[model samples]
Target chain A: MKAAVIGIGLIGGSMALALKEKGLIEKAIGVDNNVTHTTKALELGLVDDINSLEQAVQESDLVILAVPVHAISGLLPRVLDLVDRQVVMDVGSTKAAMLEVIASHPKRSRFVASHPMWGTEYSGPEAAVKDAFAGRATVICNREESDKDAVTLVEDLYTTLGMHLVYMDAAAHDVHVAYVSHISHITSFALANTVLEKEREEDAIFELASAGFASTVRLAKSNPETWASIFMENRENVLDVLNEHISQLRKFKACLEKENIEYLAELMANANKIKRILK
Target chain B: MKAAVIGIGLIGGSMALALKEKGLIEKAIGVDNNVTHTTKALELGLVDDINSLEQAVQESDLVILAVPVHAISGLLPRVLDLVDRQVVMDVGSTKAAMLEVIASHPKRSRFVASHPMWGTEYSGPEAAVKDAFAGRATVICNREESDKDAVTLVEDLYTTLGMHLVYMDAAAHDVHVAYVSHISHITSFALANTVLEKEREEDAIFELASAGFASTVRLAKSNPETWASIFMENRENVLDVLNEHISQLRKFKACLEKENIEYLAELMANANKIKRILK
Candidate 1:
């Protein structure tokens, strides 16, 4: 099968590489507004060729949207308009608002919504890496809304990439990811800023930062354009999670103020239960 | 050389392993309040033998107080009472309070306050690994206060472990680590708590959590007994940095609430400066 990947940055570029590496695609086409990204995707062998969105969608058996969440909502309906037999899939971070926008499209069944639960804090074609999706979970949202053949084709492609698939409603997927993924970026950005603000001695930070600080703030290096769009697209859920996170930080601050070691320890012990899920 | 590791937990156990692996010590003696930790330290080959704190200190040419900061402050005086020609060093997270408590002791010259800027969230001897300190910074705090020979011995030892040595004052070490290390743990614990409190679907979290979430929340699983003591011991510096972190988070929340995407993007872009230091 021939595949076209739109917005060929990290996710799209990596997806293009995965499809080609796994022999799931005879040819992978790249489509990006950034000419440099399109050219780099080709140069890096992430895609077979660069093409206009319309041209790529017209020629490929599969068209994947790997754009920002904001762009996905706008482009999903237009892509659905352009497809008849070609299976369309999106790998955006949030699903609810985009799914809602495309819900009434006549060709909605031809489109599948998915989020490959894999990414690094880096982006762009240069950041694309081979074997990026294996051993990761891929969420298929509102799978029932898609045509059976479309869902099956996408699921099979992800499985070929060695990804485990989970199914969830669009709304539920957004809420869960807001807690697990979106807020992580926010706090990490804040953490970087906190150090930048308070520890003006940049030399000390470089001299003193442990592996823990590096991993903890790693997400702060994520693409701002992409994450800002994500935060805006899933505004309510992001806001809700951000409030809870801030409240949690305040609890730690309050406990420290009162020297209430017991309460603080209890909080951390509760958090430590995450080991069961994470490990 | 003979070495005694007082705590026989993560830091100490790992230290013992590094000493053995690098041929820095012929024998490592373990001393922990917990009997199980001592047995496990030996069973895991983290130490050659287990002994009482005084016995370990007296027998070894070098003594490492690798306990929590609270324990280190108390044990340092007693360990000093037992030492004359032997060198003593500590690997605790904080230094100001501990250093102040022993500032007037004659053996203060024999004690070197060093904090290896390396650790994992897990604890105890079983969590120890060989060659744990390579490529990490080992900060020797208040170096001028340590005896010249003792300082040279540690500087050479860490250098042999493939570590880069940095020297800073105790007060500055405490303040800087609050921004770089302690605050990372606080935010990670808070991030985990936020998810556990709001996202009730444990299965969804297990399925949807990406590598980013795993790294961001990694420190949340740190040993509570160890962390609570560190927080209390460095209470002032921690509170100072935590307030700054909250202020930064509030900035993100405000921009998000107002839908001022520009400011939020700028905040993240500024945070991206961490790459210069961390990389």
Candidate 2:
């Protein structure tokens, strides 16, 4: 099968690599608005050639939309309008908005909404890595709305690449991602800002940073364009989670201020249950 | 040299292993209030034998305190009172509180206040592992207050174990740690709680959790007893950082709610500076 990956940045570039690695695609063509990304993707051997979106849709059997969330909502319907028997999928972070945009499209059956839960605090074509989606969960939304062939082809491709596929409604997917993934980025960014704001002397922070702090604040380094779009698209759910997170922190502070060790211990023990889910 | 590790749990057990690995101590002894820990430390070969605090003080040339912050403050001076010429040091998280507790002691010169910038979420003797302190920073606080011989011996031991020794004032050490280390745990614990509270169905969280969430929330699995004490001991600094952290989150939330894309983008871009510090 021939595949065309749009956006050709971290997610798209990495997906292109995975598809080629699994030998599922005979040729993977890249599509990006940024000339630098397209050139870098080709130079890095992430794709066989760079193709325009119009040409890519015309020639490829499968087309992937792996751009930022806002772009995906606008671009999916246009791609779906042009493709006949081709299976088109998006690897976006937010799903509900995009699903809404293409809900009534004539060729919506050819479009599959997928979110492979794998990424790093880096972006662009240079950030693409091999085997990026292996052993990670990929959420497929509105599967029943898509044509069986499109769903099967996308699922088989992801399965071939060693990803665990799960199904959820687009609305539900947005809520879950807000809880499990989106809130982390917000917390990390805030944590970084908190430290940077308080510790004005950069040398002290650099010298004394521990592994725990590094791990916890790692996501603060994620690309801004991608995250800004994600935060905006999933604004309501993200805001709800953010409010709860701040409330939890306030409770923790209040308990500490009162020197209520027993309550603090109980709260921590409850939080410790996260270990079971994480493992 | 003979060494005794008081409170033989995570930090002490790991320290004993490091000392044994470097051949810096001929025989290492363990002292803990819990009998299970004592037996487990001996069984795991973290120490050669289990010894009482009095026996350890009488026989060992160096004594290391690896207990919680409050315990260190209460126990260090008592241990110093019995020491003749032996060196005493601690690997606690907070420095100012512990330093202040032992400030006016006649034996203060014999004690070295140190904090190793390494830890895992797990605790107890079972959590100890070899090479724990290697390739990590060890902060020695108020070193000028320590006797020359005691400082030399403690610094030499950490150096021999392949750690970088950094000197800082006790107050500054406490403030930096609160920003870099303690706040990470607070954010992680609150994050875990936020997810658990918002996502009533555990199955969604279990299925959708990505590597990002796992890494960001990993520290939430830490032992409560250990963390509660640290938070309480460093209460003022922790609260200060927590206030700033909550304010940052509120700003992010307001930006998202108002769809203020420009501000959100700039905030994330600023947070992205953490990459340089971490790298």
TM-score of chain B of each: 0.98, 0.98
lDDT of 1 by residue, B1-279 (tens): 999989988889989988988899999999998989988888888899999888888899999999988988889999998998999999999999999999999789999999989899989889898879899898999898989999999999899999999999989989999988999999999999999998788999999899999999999999998999999999999999999899999999899899999998999999999889887
lDDT of 1: 0.92
Q: Write the per-residue lDDT of candidate 2 for residues A220-256, one digit (tens) a residue.
A: 9999999999999999999999999999999998998
Structural similarity to truth (TM-score) of each candidate: 0.98, 0.99
Question: Candidate 1 falls in which docking quality class?
Answer: high
Highest-scoring model, TM-score: 2
Best by DockQ: 1
Which ranges in model 2 have alpha carbons more than 4 Å from their true place? none
The lowest-lDDT stretch of 10 consecutive residues in candidate 2 chain B is B69-78
What lDDT score is found at residue B7 in candidate 1? 92
